[model samples]
Target: MAICKILFFLLALCIWCGKCDVFYKQVGDEVSMKCGVDSNSNIEWKFNGVLILTIDGKSGNRRKGLSHIVLKASASGDILKVPRLETRDSGNYFCRQSGKQHIVHVVSVFVKPGPVLLQSSDAELHCDITGDPNKEVQWLRPNGQTYNEKNQVIHLKSVTSNEAGQWTCLVKDDLKLSVTLTVVGLQTTAVNASKGDDIELPCSLPQSVFQRVVGGTWKAGHLPKVSFPTLTNTPSKILHWNGKDLSKVNFTTGQLSTNFDVTLKNVQSTDEGTFVCTVEFDGEVRLSVETTLRVVDKHSGKTKQHLGCTLFIRTLSFILYGLKLWIWIAVGASSVFLIGLIIVIGVVIQRNKRMKKRVRKLRSMRQPLTDKDYCQCINSSYNNCYSVIEVLQHLFF
Candidate 1:
């Protein structure tokens, strides 16, 4: 009891200071909360400081707090319940006892779907509840299977007959609220395509939902542009609705003849927007299917610039590598030529020295034979010849 009083004091202090525990809930949900005190403890519940009920533990008597709103309290007065929550039910809740406050709860209520939901379109279901913020809650699908997440929004893509039903949001042993989803109207799709690529936007309805499509026109960004003749068993090309030629777009029917698919040829950046396909029924009732187109350009200016820089760097590297190789080759060739020239000069100088020595030796050998030796041999021969001539003359006389 003392701990409970302390906790309640802190909670009341937080509320008094304009900071309190908050609960997020959707309208039409059932709300249940605990007062954080003993079940038998005599407690009073207040909404926005107006006494809604005061339970007498001894007498088990119940009194109304506000004349307009009806709130339910458990027999022990420790639990508060609201059968059908509404937007007007959103406010601060207080649990009080003799001059002491034990808890403060702030409820915020909202509506997810306004009245009805469109068929063949995207929808969301939010499971917001009132209680401990950290507490977990689960959603029970229409098929009776439990969703794996807690306190999450369930996204319904291309809602169809299978999705139109009641869904339950369960807060473990605390609260359970059910909401029915009804789907009507045309189907919508979201398309993503790169610029200059082709994309198809589908517009179709199940035969069970819609009988026949009398006539329809296509609108881009809500401006009527393309139309086709009342579809027959055979699909045909779509022409400009206002006689202005639209060369880039075409239309065809699906195999079942229920599909009105629009093909955009070579999508451009200007084509990125919402496209609506309106189909008329027998009674002039028109339903529109929407397709949201997102055009992506891979060759952006920044990307081109980056690619250009990379190419330039590669080209420069190749050129420099070639120049470096040629420079080395030229240097090697010049060194070889200079070495050959020096070897030739050295050989020529050595040959010239040898020739000069040979000439000097020849000149020495050819020096005129010594004069004395040559004269002695010639005198001897001349004297002998004179003697022989004198003897021949004496014999003749």
Candidate 2:
């Protein structure tokens, strides 16, 4: 009893000085605290120096506290129950004798948060309860598994690809604290594919996170742009590959949200570039993956730039060979035609010379004797001289 008085006096003094033992409780929780005095004596309860309730000897000292506080006393000092604690419930609480003296227990209530958000890594979560520290706390994971870590502070030691979700901590009286943790970031992958072969750009969601993805889009340098719908079987496209109405690129989803692979049919050197996939998560977060497509050709094991010189050289040689053949054909035809023309001209010239010789001989034979010509006919120089008749005709005509 003396110890009870001392404790009650100390509690009253702390309340007057605005200091008391703290009891942390979650929201929507009922706190039943133990008292250290006799239950039949008159007891007084004060909050922040204001009289809240009093159990006098007239009321048999078995009365409860205020509408929010429950006091059920026994032969010894019983417990004081504060139900449905809220933020306003956090303050100095004092219990002592009303007029003569009863028993008192002082407690300062602190309300912990119910919902929290944590980043990817370098994070810690602390949970507190109003009861004993030796008792284990119930923890509910996002995966629906119950965990009893028995720890006041939990540390997310390492993080990869950024983890985020809802975590819960549960104490007695159906009280629950939840945290929404979100970690967002990006990752990259490298892929090599040969020209004219089909390639698949990998973009898959695990079973745990497949349902969380609402929509996504895929784009590449040479690939046809395609966007998948959160609903419906057909994909929305901007342009089809290979200049056809149908798209050579296909965005395929798994039967059960287990697979998401983009197929590029007949991949060419032009199809080599970075392919990006962006997925919308929970309508707020965007997760992306970048894949680099490296298309290779076995021909010359080089790019088209290097093959340009070889192709040019081959094409020039072929053209020159055809031109040479045509030139020879033309030259041969011209030579044949020129030889035939020269022969005909030579024959006509010889024929004309013969005709002129015959005319000259005939004129000489039919010529009337001219004096000079007759004298020349006797001489060797006048063998073909015109006769006198031809000379007279020439002179008369």
Could you say which candidate leads in lDDT?
A: 1
Clashes of 2: 11
Cα lDDT tens digits, model 2, 204-285, are 5543331244555666655455432231222432211222223566653334243556677788888788888766544255
Candidate 1 clashes: the total is 3
Query: lDDT, candidate 2, residue 11?
Result: 49
Candidate 1, residues 83-194: lDDT per residue as tens digits?
Answer: 5666556555667653333232223322244314445455667654333344466778789998777764666665676776788877545546677777666666687666
How does model 2 score by TM-score? 0.35
- Per-candidate TM-score against the hidden true structure: 0.32, 0.35
Candidate 1: C-alpha lDDT: 0.60
Judge candidate 2 at residue 241 and give its lDDT: 20
Q: What is the lDDT of residue 97 in candidate 2?
A: 49
